[model samples]
Target: MSKAKKSIEVEITEKKAGNGKTVSEVYIGKQFLGNVREDDNKFLMTTAKNESFKVNSFDEGIQELIKEFHLHH
Candidate 1:
């Protein structure tokens, strides 16, 4: 018998905010994860629960959201 391999997948999409700036939307499966926006030279990440974080890069923003999701779930 063969065992099934399980993996975690994340999706990111670029969206236009009301102010006409681009933001990255993160999703885990079908659930909405968070949004990462570039402000000055730092990336601002905001979770679905409205929690916020300031990161250095887009990848860091996504990592923060994933950490929050794992902590909560």
Candidate 2:
């Protein structure tokens, strides 16, 4: 018999914020993962753990966050 390993899946959503800027929110199985926002051509992201970081690219934030959580093997 073989056991199935659990995998991590993240959901990403991009929407216009009230400031009229693009905001991307990440969620993992209904749990708030993190959010990345665009400001003055820079990207700022805050993790669900309240850890804030600056990223040059929008996707970098969530990708790093996932790595931080050790979600991928």
Best by lDDT: 1
TM-score of each: 0.86, 0.73
Report model 2's TM-score to 2 decimal places. 0.73
| Cα lDDT for residue 49, candidate 1 | 88
Please identify model 2 stretches exceeding 4 Å from their true place.
1-6, 71-73
lDDT of 2 at 52: 89
Please write out the lDDT profile of model 1 over residues 1-73, one tens digit for every residue.
Answer: 9989868899999999999989999898999999999998889999998888889998888888998888988
Superposed by TM-score, candidate 2 places the C-alpha of residue 38 at a distance from the truth, in angstroms, of 1.3
RMSD of each: 2.7, 3.4
Q: Which parts of model 1 are misplaced by more than 4 Å?
A: 1-5
User: What TM-score does model 1 achieve against the real structure?
Assistant: 0.86
> Could you say which candidate leads in TM-score?
1
* lDDT tens digits, residue span 9-71, model 2: 899989898888888988878877789998788889988788889999887887877766666
